[model samples]
Target: MGKKKVSALVLATTMVLLSACNVNMGGGDTASKPADAASKPAGSSSSAPQKVVFWHAMGGSNTKVVDQMVSDFNASQNKIQVEAVYQGSYDDLLSKLKTSMGSSDGPSIVQMYEIGSRFMIDSKTITPMQNFIDSEKWDVSQLEPNIAGYYTFGGKLYSMPFNTSNPILYYNKDLFKAAGLDPAKPPKTYEELKAAADAITKTGKATGANFAIYGWFIEQFFANQGSDYVNNGNGRTSQATESLVNNEAGVKTLAWWKDLIDTKAANNLGRKTDDSKKAFSAGQVGMILESTASLKGLVDSAAGKFEVGTGFLPKPADAKEGGVVVGGASLWMMNNKPNEEQKAAWEFIKFLTSPKEQAYWHINTGYFPITKKAYDEDSVKDNLKKFPQFQTAIDQLHQTKLNTATQGAVMGVFPEARQIVEGAIEEVLNNKKSPKDALDAAAKEITTKIQQYNKTVK
Candidate 1:
C-alpha cells in the first residue's frame, strides 16, 4: 500500500545511516553502580545510588501529582535517584525522543501515548515491561483488566498503563432543565441526541451542543457503533494493511453530526476542545463529549455557574450497542540505560502503581486509578463522595463489552493517520466533500503510510 517503491540506492543509503547510529544508541552515561548488589530498591548499602532520567508529557494541573510521586519515591529510596523532567505535550515528547534516539542523553524511562505502541516495539529502543514482570514474578491481577488489555498485544505488555480515561457525554444540567428536558435522562442514541440538542437550542440562552472535531472522538464513535477502524481485527491479530473507516457506520456517524451543524442544533466551534469546553462552562452550550480526564477541571470551571452532569457516549439507534476505549498515556522503560538503572526504574514504577499512590493520583486528577485497590483508600472514597459525577465514567468502563472494536486499533503510523482523518472530517463539516469521498481519500493515504511503515520495520 505504499505510494511508490523506493529505489534500491536510496534504501541502501538510509540503511547505512541507521547502522552507524545504532552502534552508539544504547550506551554512555550509565553511571557507576555495583552490578553485584543483592539487596537494592530502598535498602541498598551501595554508596553511589543508581541515577534514572524519566521523561514525561504530563503538564498543567496533573504535573504536581507526578512531581510529588517522583519526589516521594526518591526520598524513600537509597539505591535509585530518579529525575523526572516535564517534556511538553505527547507529540512533542515523541519528537524529542526520536531526535535523542542515537544519543546517550535519552531517558531511562518515558511516557508515551497509546497509539505509538507498534512504533515503540519496532524501534527496539525500549525493553518490554513483560520481561521485567516475568523476572520479578509480579502479580498484575490488581490492575484494571480493560486498561491492561489495551497495552497488551501478542501476550506482551510493552508498557505500564499509568493514567487511564474514557470519553463521556458532559452536559449542563441547568440548561437541560431550563429547556424543559429531563436532566436525569440524557439521550443515549444519535437520533435522541439530535432531538435534545434541538430542544436546548430553541431556548435563547445557549446552543444545543458543541463537540470538538477530534479524531479520537471519531474513533470512539466507530467503536460505539461496533465498527472497525482497520482490518485484521482492529490490528490486534496482525499488522493491519488497510483502513476501514469509510464503511456504513462511519458515513452515518459523519452524516448525523453534520446534520446537527446544518440544522443549527450544534455549533461548529472549530477543532479545539478548549473552545467547546469554554462554551459549555459558560452555559453557551448544553452538551459536549470529552474524556473523563477533563472532569475535575470542568467541575471547577462550572462551579457556582451551571450544574455539570455526565452520560454514556451516544450511539446510532440502529447500531449495535458498544463501549468506549481507554485514553491516556503509559510508561515505558528505555533500553539505553544500564541493567542496574533499569532495575531501579522498575522500583519507581512499582511505587507509582501502589494502592496509596494510585489513590492519590485518582483523587488529584480526573484519570481512573490503574489498580482496583486504590478505591479502598479513604482519600478516593472521600473524593468520590464529594464529586459523584466521576462515577459516570467508571460505570461506563465497567459496562463496556470488551471486544476488538472497543479495544481500539493499533498501527505504527497512528498519529499521522489521525491527522489525515481530521482533514477528512474537516472536509465533511465544511461541505468541501461528501463524507464517503473524504474518508475514502484519507483511508487511501493512511494505507500507504501503514504499508511503508511495515516495510521499514521488516
Candidate 2:
C-alpha cells in the first residue's frame, strides 16, 4: 500500500507482507501458520443495500470462518451485500493492492497486516477510520486499548483491528518435568530463561530454547526493555527519521540471541518460526516464543505428548519498563469508494467487532477478542475454561505498561527495516560480524530507507 516504489533492497523482493499475519502462525508469516482467528462486531445502515467488497488475506480454516461471517452478515441485512474475497496470503494481497491503486475496482475495505499501517496512511488511498468514529460518535471505549493503540497514529485511528495478537513464551512442561526442573517455573527474564535453557540442555532431555530470528521478536525485546525501535516516540509523536535499533538494547538482544545458539543451549532455527514450533512439539526444544494466537494449535499439537505451559515473553532482568506490542492485521476502509459503500463497509466492520461475533471468533480461532465485552459472553467463558493457557496472554496484556515503546514503532519502510534487522541478526549469529557492527550497518541502511520514505510521504 505504498504510493511510490519504496525500499526493499535488503529483501530483494517487493515489500511482501512480512507482517504479523497470525505473526506467520497466527501473526508470523500467515502461510505456514494456522488460519487467523478474527471476528467483527455490528452496526446498521438504514440506506439501500450496496455491494461492499472486502479483500482479505486469510487462508485455510480462518478463511472459511471469515467467509461464514460474511455470509452471516449478508443474510442478516439487505443494506450491504459484502463479497468477501480471499486475496491469497498477506504478501499477495499487498502486491495486488499496490497494482490496483489507480483503479476503482479495488476492495471497499481491505484487511492489511499491522506493520502496513504506516504505508497505508501514507498512500492516502484509504479513509482513516477516525472520520467515521467521530461522525457517528462511536464509543470506541468498547475496543481493547492495547490492540487499538497499534492502529492509532498522529492522534487518530487509521484502521479497525480485525484479528489481533501478541507474543508469549511457550514451554513444554513434560520436558521440564523430565529434566527434574519445576514445570510451573517458566522463565521471567533473559538470565532466568538462559538458566532454564542451560538446565534443560544439561539434562540431555531437550534443548533449552528455540526462538525464531524474527524482527518482530527483536522489536518486542526492545519494547520489553523500554527502548524505542526508531526515533520520535516510536514514530507516534511525529514522523520517524532515523533508526534506533543499534543502541545498547539492540546489541544486548542480538548478542544474547547469538550466545544462546553458540552455547548449544538453544537451536538456531533460522527465521522460520514453524521449525521452532515443530521442535518444541517434538520435545526437541523446551521453550519457544510465538503469538498468542498459537495457543489452541500448540495445545493441540502437544496433546497426549506433553503438557504445554504459557508464560509472558522474556525480557532482560533489568527491563522493568516496556511491554509487548499487538501483532496481527486490521481492516482499512478504502477512500476510492463512494461514501455509501464505505458506510456499508463500516456496518460490516461494526458487526465484526460486536461482542457476539467477537466471542465466536475468539472461541474458534484463538485471537483475543477486540472488544472487552466479548469476554462476558458465555461461549467465550466456556472456551477459556477449556483452554486456560489463554489466561497467561490476558494477564500479560493487562500487566503491560502502555507507553510509546509498547505502542510500537511506525515507519513507511517498516517491512524492509524488519528484513534488514534479520539480516543483521543472521550476520551476528553466523559469526560474520560483531553485534554492534552488524547492527550499526543495518541501522545505517534503515536510516537511509526511512529518509527516502519520509521524502516521498511528505
Candidate 3:
C-alpha cells in the first residue's frame, strides 16, 4: 500500500520517452497533418496477393489463437496475404508504432488497447474504420452495441472491435453449497456479494472472496452506478479535463470494498490478477472478480478440484441495472498507404472480424466475440454448451445500455490515470487513508497530469 518514490533520473527518462514519441498524456483533437505513406517495393506485381503487415501484442494462448486466425485468413483467399507480427506488450507496441510512424515503416494494421484509442486518433497515423465502412456501405448491424460503444466516439466508429471482454464474478460452487448458500444463485449487488462472502468465510469453506486491486473493476463499478469516469460525458462529447473518481459512486464503491476487507470477508490480493485467480482456482478463496477472458484458465485450473460458476459484476443495491464497460484490444488500420495496400488491409480486417473467425477466436481464447451473430455460430454455440459460464458475459453485454458512462473514458493519459486510481485503492484497502481522501488525492494528481499533457500537445 506504500507508494514507491521515483528518482529524478527515472522521472526525467520517462519525460524524454513521452516527448520523443510526441505523446500527449491527455485527450485532444485529431492532428490536421496527414500521415506519411510507406513506399511500395520496386517491381511489385499487381496480380499477386498484396502483402499486408499487422502488428499485435497478443501473447501466450492469445498469440496461438491469433496466429491460427491469421493463417486461416491467408489460406482462405489469395487477394490479400497478411503477415501477423508479434510486437511485444501493448505499451511496447505503442512505443514501436510511434517510432515507425515517424518514418514510413509502420504496419498496415495494428492492434491497439482500448485506452490507446484517444491517443491513436490524435496521432493521425490511422484511418477511422467508419471511413471504410461508409465507403463499402458495409452493414455493421451485427456488431455488439456495448462492444462497439467503447471504441465509438462522436458517433463514429474509430476502430474494429476484436477480442472484447467484460468483468464477471466467478464463484466456487462447491464452496457455496458447503456454506449453505445456493450454488445456483450468485450475488447480483454489492450487499448480496458481501453477505455471501461473509457466510462462506464464517463457515470455513474458504478464506474469503478475493480480487486484484485493479482499476478496471472500479471503472465497472462506476458504470454500474451510472456515473461518469471523467468530465465531458466520460470524454466522449469533448476532451476530459478532470476525473470524477472522488464522487459519491467512487466513495461508496471503495468504502464497500474496504468494509469487506476490514470485516475479513475478502482479501487484499494486491495488484496481481493472477494471484487472486490462483487463490480462487486452488479453493483458497470462495469467489473472485476477474475478466471474462480468464474463463478458460479458471475452468482448466479448477478441473477435478471444484466447479466454477460465473455471474455479471455486482452492482449497487440501490443502483439501477446499469452495465459494465468493455475491455480488450481492437484492430486499427493505418493510413497513408497505397490504394491496393489499404484495401488489402481492410480485407484482412474484415476476415478477422467475420462471424466464423470471431467464433473461432472466442472459442479458442475465451474472449467474447464482438459480433452478435457469432453467438449463433455452431462453434460458439458448442463452446457455450460446454461452458455455460461464458454466457454471463454475453448476457451482460446485451443488457448494457449505450450510455457515456458505459462507453468508458477516453483520455490520452488513461493508462496513467488507471495506475493512479489503483494506487488510491491500495491506500484505502490498507487503511492508510479514507476512501474519499484517497480518491480525492488521486483525482487531484490525475487532473494535474492531464493539464500538463494538454499544454504540451497544444
- Model 1, residue 417: distance off in Å is 1.1
What is the TM-score (0 to 1) of candidate 1? 0.91
**What clash pairs does model 3 have?**
none
What ordering of candidates by TM-score runs from best to worst? 1, 3, 2
Q: Which residues of candidate 3, in runs, are more than 4 Å off?
A: 1-45
lDDT of 3 by residue, 1-458 (tens): 00121222332344456667776432122221122235343114566878889999888777888899889988987767889899887767776876676455888889988877877776666778887787667787878888888998888888998878889999999999988899999999999999999999998768769978988889999998899999999988988889898999999999999999999999887998889998998999999999898898899999999999999899888985578899888988777555557667877888877889888988888888888788889988899889989888888888899899899988767777888999999999999999999999999988887666555444
Which should have the higher TM-score, number 2 or number 3? 3
lDDT of each: 0.82, 0.82, 0.82
Q: What is the C-alpha RMSD of each candidate to the true structure, in Å?
A: 5.0, 7.9, 4.6
CA shift of 114, model 1, Å: 1.2
Error of 1 at 384 (Å): 1.0
Among residues 3 or more apart in sequence or in different chains, the pairs in candidate 1 whose N, CA or C atoms overlap within 3 Å are none
Name the regions of candidate 1 deviating beyond 4 angstroms: 1-45
What does the lDDT come to for candidate 2?
Answer: 0.82
lDDT score, candidate 2, position 110: 94
lDDT of model 2 at residue 442? 96
